[model samples]
Every structure is written in C-alpha cells, then in structure tokens.
Target: MMTALLLHGYASGIYSSRRIARAAVERADFMMIVAGDAPDFRTISEFRRRHLKALADLFVQVLKLAEKAGLVKLGHVALDGTKIKANASKHKAMSYD
Candidate 1:
C-alpha cells in the first residue's frame, strides 16, 4: 500500500502506479508489504467527489510512511501537460477562464 501510494504521487493514476507496484512486488528486496487492488480508473466527476476524502487520507498515510523511511526530501520534479484530444465539440470548452 505504501509503495503503491508513493508511486501514485509520482505517476498520474492507479493504472500507471500499478505497473510500478507490480515491479516492486516481484522483487523480495523491500520490507514493505503489498496489499489490495489499486483504486478504480473511472473518470466520472461523481466518483472523484465520492473518493476525495479517501484519497486525501491515503496521501497522508503515504507521507507518513515516507517520513518513517527517511525519504521525505524534495528533489527534481517534472510536470507534464495532458494532451486531451476531445471528440466533443470545441465550443463546449470555449468559456472564460
């Protein structure tokens, strides 16, 4: 769980994080225990609202684990803009920001 959440902070979603989690799980090198399935991949707004609190809690747990492991240090970070090719009409997104 700790590994999954840590990977999630670096990656975008659970689907991507799961790949990293699988790799870590394969190696018996770490002391961490892998548990449970990754979160669902649905992108619905309602799902986000419903899971917001749970996600926040999970984030706190991840940070605590990092602190315990002495890995809580800032390093080089990268932010990537999502390239969304919408099939919907562009006019739907044309509004004052």
Candidate 2:
C-alpha cells in the first residue's frame, strides 16, 4: 500500500495527487517504501505513458488505506477545475504572483 502511494502520488504527473502522496508518506503510521532518487522530467513523461493505469491503481490503493485508517469517510464527492493561461501564451504573459 505504501509502495502504491509512492508510485502513484508523488510520481504521478498530477500536482494534487503528488501533494496527497507526499502527505501520506510523511505520516509515521503508514509503511514506507524508498524509491532511490527522483526521476528527471523526461523520464517522468515516459513513465506516464508507460505506466499511467498502474499508477492510478496505486492512488486508489492509497485512498483505501486512508479509509481504513479512518482518515476519510466514504461519501459524496465533488470536482472542479480552474484554468490559467500558460506562460508561453503572449496574451497572458504576466508574472506569477
């Protein structure tokens, strides 16, 4: 389960997922799995293409662990997204605040 969280949470490309994974890893109660070193951006991109579903499954496993630990309840859910223009976009070339 810890292994799953490491691979899915921190290693996943999604920013929020990585944050969740990092939080899980920091918890002393959870089992730990040491991945030697951080992969470079290119390697991460390759991993996403090659192992996306597997990583997603790991995320799910982490969620189950949280449920088992009584950290999160099984219930309703909501989702939302906010889009900001990329730095490369000339129309939105503003300094990050």
Model 1 alpha-carbon drift over 4 Å, by segment: 1-45, 73-97
Highest TM-score against the true fold, candidate: 2
- Residue 1, model 2: Cα distance from true site in angstroms: 14
TM-scores for candidates 1 onward, in order: 0.33, 0.43
Cα displacement (angstroms), candidate 1, residue 22, comes to 20
The per-model lDDT (C-alpha) reads 0.51, 0.55
29 Cα displacement, candidate 2 (Å): 16
Cα lDDT of model 2 by residue, 1-97, tens digit: 4334445455444345344444444643222432433334444455566877887786788779989999878888887788876667665777567
- Model 2 residue 95 lDDT score: 57
Summarize candidate 1's per-residue lDDT along 1-97 as a digit string, tens digits. 5434444434444334444445344534321434433333232234445776786787677777887899886467999998987667677758667
